[model samples]
Target: MESSDTTVVRASQPPPVQHEFALRFTSTPRGARLARRLVSHRLDEWGYGYESPVNESLTLIAAELAANAVQHGQVPGRDFRLRLTATSGILRIEVTDTLTERVPPQSVPEVPGDAESGRGLLLVDRLATRWGTCPRSAGPGKTVWAELTDAAAW
Candidate 1:
């Protein structure tokens, strides 16, 4: 049987050069893990696989943002949403959680060498072309987003 993680896009006519997909998953560590894996799988299916640097960078960004949502923004019984959109040469990622009050700190603190936590956003800042947060259009909560420009011709 085909796994729920796999989504196949078929074009009745000519396929557009751009595509998008969005999903919502439970706000938990397991869900966060699935989000990252699904992103890699989808990118592969989209012809990026793991060979492209852009796809690799996107995977990393998705991992960190999803982890942050599960760790910092999770609210009991609520789910987080992952949105991926590719247009022209840009890929945009959006992860939204239920807890709007616990938004991630804009600037990561400079911790000592022995510090073990607090580097997720730092990694995101370094990898994503651009990223930020905004209030959810539906209601409460906020959406954290990042964009990656395709390294190859699209």
Candidate 2:
């Protein structure tokens, strides 16, 4: 959704518009699904889609990030926030949950030889230009963010 807040520019020039979308969802499997769906829609709106390799890569990244927030950062009665920010040359995705101390493992977890789980962050790490976690600016939780640059945006 569009934000009402605006940034002022020179009187002679219109303000630069930034594309952004933010939403909070329950820390559940359903929430993660919705987050991924919305991101895919937004990506398509921004002209990245089935034919664009960037679309497939970033869509998977968003899904993995959202899933991590639900699986590792879920707290009773707490919801997670997924925010999307995009410009011509960059796109950033951030997922925040009420879990200040539950940072992602320092390195991607290695799955056992026969295990059926543990690859989300591995995919994120490989696909994103950069990804990391930081304490939320004004809350008890932390935010995990990843960015994809111009080279990956096309």
Candidate 3:
């Protein structure tokens, strides 16, 4: 008599998944606040908890970039765009505005000790694995982007 046997094998790596969220908001302080809240909500939907470090960091980055867009990049009758994309163990957050003349400084600037503002990008630089500004792909504006790489967060 002959015996039957079965062999099982599993994939060494899981398939790559990509997630994206994009929206345009009025260039106002209220809009900026909404952008930050939505980013946290979307990240929660994508598997990161509200209290997770990844969620908190990305939410803060979104708030800062959105605030900058409203304060410095706002244009009359124009809106700003917020985009979030996660793929291949990386998460990218981008804020695009209609104002093109103003661009973010290449390096973080020193803030006066008594200044009431101007520390957003500094916080972004510290939290993001990578961050920068680039001309908007299809419009007259700039897109400030920051990326976080934490495999466990995905």
The models' CA-based lDDT, in order, is 0.85, 0.84, 0.93
Ranking the candidates on lDDT from highest down gives: 3, 1, 2
Which scores better on lDDT, 1 or 2? 1
Query: If candidate 2 were superposed on the true structure by all CA atoms, what would the RMSD be?
Result: 9.5
Task: Name the 10 consecutive residues with the lowest summed lDDT in model 2.
Answer: 10-19
| Model 3 alpha-carbon drift over 4 Å, by segment | 1-17, 151-154
| Candidate achieving the largest lDDT | 3
For each of the candidates, the C-alpha root-mean-square deviation to the true structure, in angstroms, is 12.7, 9.5, 7.3
Order of the predicted models by TM-score, top scorer first: 3, 1, 2
Q: Residue by residue across 2-98, what tens digits does model 3's lDDT show?
A: 9989888976784355899999999999999999999999999988889989999999999999999999999999999999998878899999998
Which residue runs of candidate 2 sit more than 4 Å off their true CA positions?
A: 1-17, 151-153
Q: RMSD of candidate 1 to the true fold?
A: 12.7
Question: Per-residue alpha-carbon lDDT of model 2 for 80-154, expressed as tens digits?
Answer: 999888765778899989888788876787777787778888889999989999898777999999888883436
Which residue pairs in candidate 3 have backbone atoms (N, alpha carbon, C) closer than 3 angstroms, thus clashing?
none
Query: Between 1 and 3, whose TM-score is larger?
Result: 3
